[model samples]
Target: MDDLALSVRTARPEDAADLARIYIESWQDTYAGVISHTLLGAMSPRTHTTRWQATIRTMEKHSGTVLVAEDARFGAVGLCSLGKARDGGCGYDGEVYTLYVDPAFLGRGAGRALLTGAFEAFKDRKLRSCLIWAHAQNNACFFYEAMGGRRVATRTTRLLGELTPEIGFGWKRLAARKPARPMQSRSDQS
Candidate 1:
């Protein structure tokens, strides 16, 4: 599958529905035990679609961006959002607001490719650093760590009658550095 073709591009308004589907699927699968069942159950496909459409519209209105990863077979398999960090009170210089890969594509390199694309976008904007947040129970924390992110802070809150803790990871020069070695490559995976 080394020759399997895939592309990464800036998300378009037309891609919102597909992006949302992947987002919801990934979230439900990855966050099932970590988030409240009530919250999870409440997030229907319509909710994700509406939210993604609105976000895409707003990003188009402004200068922010969303990105999508597409494979020849799976169409859009991953998505991510990037914008100025100040939009939220989290206070990072820049933020990766969303990053989700289809559950089927999880072990592949689609997530890394999507993130590398985001880093290029941030670099083009001259941003110096960026932040990503993941729930403590999500295994993505380790992936971020492997990608050179440093744990900067931890946040705790109650969701769905349970205590959920989130960890924040920061990449000081998300756009400027190169990986020391090539990440593993997979063909036709995403």
Candidate 2:
């Protein structure tokens, strides 16, 4: 998809609306059938605008980065957030706070590219490891595994008054690893 011409850069305050749209669309698409529709509905634009606005407006004090992926053809298609672990329990540990790509961009390498950008940001700060949490029932579990993340733990919690389970993945020197082989190629026999 080289012809797609995607670009990843830090998000600006002006991007709040686009980022919020992507978050809602991606979450709804990715969490369908996994998270209760009621819960998702409760967390949609009307309920999440304030939180998303604050996220886009407030800059983290630590070595953190938020990136948005755009394409001339697709506009703001994906976004990711990475930062130091909040509690300092894992010294110098970085975290992939959020990573989401437009459903239309799925299978086009947008998610992988966004994650690569996040890793590079962490590496620039000299972080040795990174952590990411994914919903256990979400298909992204396989994607995280393919990215070389090892499952470290799982936790269940009540969100929006419904039980949800999240799986944690860890990666060391994540930025240093080569990108995974693409699922399709020009010579694919299929």
Candidate 3:
């Protein structure tokens, strides 16, 4: 990850397809054994694209945010959607609705970059604390823990028809970050 260069940006409507692909691929990779193959196979890229496009628009219209992570050569590798807390009684000012990295790009720092971007957006919105709910069985929980989140709660929700359990990870405070300075290449310095 040290050598990988990644950038996070606000997602636009044009990124819907890329996000859709990432969503499907990541879901398949992450939930294969836990979720039924039939259910996973039912995921539709076209439908996801439409939903994501509308979602991006709505997020922009509202105060929420959608973020995309890109590599210099691999294009869009990950996405994160976040906004005000939706579920009541969470005691969190902000919530990360979804965070997924393309299967091929996992462990390459895309997730890290996107989470960092989400926190920055939180600060801009004056959201001082954050919460993320992930499937109880998903490995993403480990990643969230590595990112300084504390396990605060758990609950069950419906996914398709099955009752799915989730773990809530909370961050009591977010550190303010300064704007990054652009790097100058040696060739440009000459």
Candidate 4:
């Protein structure tokens, strides 16, 4: 898996459908046991595509970026959305809003590549630190821990009538950290 070739680049409007597929698939794969079945069943890729398309259209070039990772055989296997911290009180300068990889591509480098790409983007914006949130019960939460993130906070949020506990992981000195792969320029597309 370490030798697999993967590419990461800025996501465009044309990539919405693929991104939505990856997003919903990854969510279903990761949150099946941790989240309510009713809520998971309610996720609509069509609705998400519209939201994603709107996001791409409204993003300020320097403020945030959405990057997609593609395998040589599979296109748009993973994605990551990054930007300013949603809550200014979090003490982190930037946030990884989301990161998801197709279930088939898990354990490969897609997730790492997307994450590395996001960090590079944060560094490009001169951000010093970043944070990401994941459901505490999600098995993939260990991926964050393995990447050197330290648990900084935790909160319970309501989702589909159920309270879900989430853990926040933070990484400081991002500019000093090396990316897992060389991040492609904004002009690069999968």
| Candidate that scores best on lDDT | 3
Name the regions of candidate 2 deviating beyond 4 angstroms. 1-3, 42-50, 87-92, 176-190
Candidate 4 clash pair list: none
- Of 3 and 4, the candidate ahead on lDDT is 3
Residue 9, candidate 3: alpha-carbon lDDT: 93
> TM-score for every candidate vs. truth?
0.83, 0.82, 0.90, 0.87
Pitting candidate 1 against candidate 4, the one with the higher TM-score is 4
What are the per-model numbers of colliding residue pairs? 0, 0, 0, 0
lDDT of 1 by residue, 85-147 (tens): 753525566788889999977766777777788888877776768888788878999988977
The CA-based lDDT of model 3 is what? 0.86
TM-score of 3: 0.90
* Residue runs of model 3 more than 4 Å from their true location after superposition: 176-190
Candidate 3 — number of clashing residue pairs?
0
lDDT of 4 by residue, 1-190 (tens): 3344688899998899898888888877887877777788888989999989988777656488899888666678888898888867289999998899899878766777877788888888888799998888886589888787889999998655678998999997774444465344323545
Model 1: ten consecutive residues of lowest lDDT: 179-188
* Model 1 vs truth, CA RMSD: 3.8
